[model samples]
Target: MSTARVWAPRPATVAVQIDGVRHPMTPGEGGWWEGPDLPPGARYGFLLDDDPTPRPDPRGRRLPDGVHGLSQAALPRLAPLDWPGRELRDGVIYELHVGTFTPEGTLDAAVARLGHLVDLGIDFVELLPVNAFNGTHNWGYDGVAWFAVHEAYGGPDAYAGFVAACHARGLGVIQDVVYNHLGPSGNYLPLYGPYLRDQAANTWGQEVELSHAEVRRYILDNARMWFEEYGVDGLRLDAVHALRDTSDEHILRTLSRETDDLSRRLERPLTLIAESDLNDPVMFRPRHEGGHGLTAQWSDDYHHAAHVALTGETAGYYADFEPLTALGRVATRGFFHAGTWSTFRERTHGVPLDDDVEAWRLVTCLQNHDQIGNRAAGDRLSASLSPRRQAIGAVLAVLTPSTPMLFMGEEWGASTPWQFFTSHPEPDLGRATAEGRFAEFEKMGWNRDVVPDPQDPATFQRSKLAWDELAHEPHRRLLAQYRDLIALRSREPDLRSPRLGDLSAEIDEHERHVTFVRGRIRIRLNLGDATWRPEGEEEALFATSDDVSGNPLMLPPDSALVSRTIE
Candidate 1:
């Protein structure tokens, strides 16, 4: 016999609809409803008030049919894993969507591709959120059930199998989790306790109630459950800036302390990486320092500066960063807007990283999900830049002082676009997304008619990785270069050092040339239309283009050259 409990704070009466029969539930204190002697495979949904529609359990452990049908109490086959001893800062990470990572579009299939990643020299595999969303296909941000792995991705058992496989291969698995808000469809959290804030709002609708004690407990408990039960090495917190909690002790701090305690008990490394737009150094500072003790956070300034410098497209946030000097600042200081004015916000923002903080506290990337997918056409760097330039970007990313991360297929410079796509079963949800997407682009002066409907099936299919591209000539060369660069980063002492002062960047804005110096290694790039010859004596190490020659080096347009300074 199994028992089920759900929190319906506002409901006057709650009943469990099981096999065409309604079983009245006992309402416990604090708006919780409980039922005893329920079967494991029982088909039950909560009936609130006079409403005809039955809602799935808000804290459903398993969703058998996507997010629309029965909530099963089915026990997961594999027990939660015990985390292996490993530090996130010590390894390179490769982020991928399980559905698009392989042709099979399942966790088991993704396991088959782990050898390829291991061969590529990546230490951690950061998966997009696997939580149950509204449909069969999505970017995974619109997650409804935070606990249950999506049924489309082989359910809870398959997820355990995938994690176990990764551990066996000596690779750490990082799961992306969404705590800011839930999706529109199948979002029964509001019907429950104070899971959502009726007063507060985020860019994506209602915000999670982190200030409330019970709500705070729920969120913290969920985070700990994944680490303690699932053996997850680390969590990539999605859009942390949107998590509004005015409590004296922020929820992030609480999570950091809990995770730290768990890590000590398990005798393994556990990390928390936050996806934050706020460039506040407090996120990386230790809890004892009167700051939130997150391990690392995404550095958008690095991407914005690097992208604008390479692509020369200064639209949107790129407007704030047109010159190479901004990129230089990020290279040396770890933040471009360090107490400086932000042109985008028209306000002073971001605190500079403390002198004691290492560069690994920041994670930099050229093409992340938001950077690539939010584009009007989802065009990747390969779509805009030539193969040589793409290689240059990769070298710059890996050689930087901060920890580097690569999106799937970016190593080979795959030409396929990863556009925003979803397969919401509800017609209302589909329509809402279509209208909302167009409206968003309209503010940026984009043609609304030209924007592809995210609800379209073709949109999702187009985002899948083209595994065949890996075998192609140009792609193969780029892939080899990436492996070599990662290998070099791992072997070179100076490259792995996260010291901020050990890095410097020399830039000629008019010539469109930038040279980054990290210890004995100096990497120079010609972003202009003309080739440049080096002034001092330097031995050539690597060049994206083959045009450079002689002791005084010459770099071709949209190319990069790396050399070691001769004494």
Candidate 2:
């Protein structure tokens, strides 16, 4: 018999609307209202209390038109994943939002574009969250259904098909998952158990109750389902620091152990990458060593320093990173704010990492979703800097000591912006979002009207990747340069080494020039407007801006020159 359930803990009365007929639901002990014998593809919604409004099912798997409509259940075919190939550290990763990667904006369409990523020499395609969220278009951070893939993105089976296709093409797939908090809308976990807590808060809102036993199990099961059931090679846990847990055996540690067991059972290597603001090495340390045992974490220290130095604009969080010395520190130490005083936080942040830790333990990128989209108008480095400068940023991002991640269309330098967008069905939610967004920037002295409405359909349309731009001259040249740099990185032993001290940067901050040396190869960058000479004899291996073939090593403004030292 089919059953319908609604989660309304605080509400005294709850009713279900099925096929235009209203039926009173029996409220269970755990704030769950259930009705048996409901048919498949049932058209249902919840009526909370005496209110005339019918709310959409919080755990609804499929919303065809929008929220407050029929809930469609899709049973997707599950497949076994074989992952006995190259390690993540040995390859390049290209991060893409499935909705904006192509014109079709579905998993099947993304599968068709797998050849492009393969041809670009990318080892892994890290997709943004594909789980169902509110409305049609979103950033995917507000996903509610952790198990079911978005129906708009071709449902769960389509995701499985995409993974199978990626595996067939020898491309590893990493799914970005959010376990810290649920979306503002369509959140039902609270009614089931203590999945959310009122005590602890994160940047977004209330934190998920990782300290609770059942809640921990629910999250762990979700992670395993993705790796085992969905055939994803790795998981990128979003905002791990926001996960509030005071358990002696932390949920993260438990997740790592469970993933390890799954990997052993499947006889394949599975990885867990955390998006952590906490620069604690414990995230990468082994569980046996009294640590969380995550495989890797995104290192914002490297990105912040690199971005601030390159752009010379220090507003908001960038204010703490005005000096280029911070970039040099992260390059050589793996943490710029390693127990040092942070002007932004007014606190000493991050413990210093050991010099011998592998660079793959940290992922570094100059431009990612948060870096570009969180801006005033989602302006990318390509929008602010010249093509030559953009190429230089790419070179530094890839050639650095840490494992590099490239955003969608970054290699080709697409001009499109990846702005924050959402399409909430509730009018109150839409109005709240608009007011909240304006107020958020107003506190920072930014014009409130300048903040784009997240509910606008145009916002999502603007974020899509521009594929035709790839064929252009400057964009193609930059793409080729990125290809060659990654190729060299894969072949070069020194570049792959994780030894932090082995990496050194020689910079003239006043002159806007810097040189990065790894073993015998030297990467000379001239951010100055005039030409400059290197310290020693150097041959141009790669030039991002001007052609230095016949001309002597006189650097130009915002130019990059790579060379190998004479033995």
TM-score each candidate. Answer: 0.94, 0.89
Candidate 1 overall lDDT versus native: 0.84
What local lDDT score does residue 473 receive in model 2, on the 0 to 100 scale? Answer: 79
Kindly report the root-mean-square deviation of model 2 from the true structure over all alpha carbons: 3.7
Candidate 2 has what TM-score? 0.89
List candidate 1 segments past 4 Å from native: 12-29, 37-42, 47-54, 76-83, 536-540, 548-554
Show model 2 residue runs off by greater than 4 Å.
1-77, 82-86, 549-553
Top candidate when judged by lDDT against the true structure: 1
Give, for candidate 2, the lowest lDDT window spanning 10 residues: 68-77
Candidate 1 similarity to native, TM-score: 0.94
Angstrom error of the Cα, residue 272, model 2: value is 0.7
- Candidate 1 lDDT over 1-567, as tens digits, reads 557687778889988887667888999987778976567677777888887777787666788976877777654332344445469775898999988888778999999999999999999899999999988898999898888899989988798888888888889888999999988887777776677878778888798888777777777777876776677788999999998878999989999998899888877889899999899988978999998999999899999998998788998789889988998889888999989899999999999776677899899988888899999888899988878788888887777778899999999999889999988778987998989899999888999877878999888888889999999979999999888888888987767756786778899999988988878878788888887877777887766756765368778788777677788
Q: lDDT per model, in order?
A: 0.84, 0.80
Name every residue pair that clashes in candidate 2.
Answer: none
lDDT of 2 by residue, 170-262 (tens): 998899999988888877555445678887778777888777665677788788888877788899999998876789898889999999998
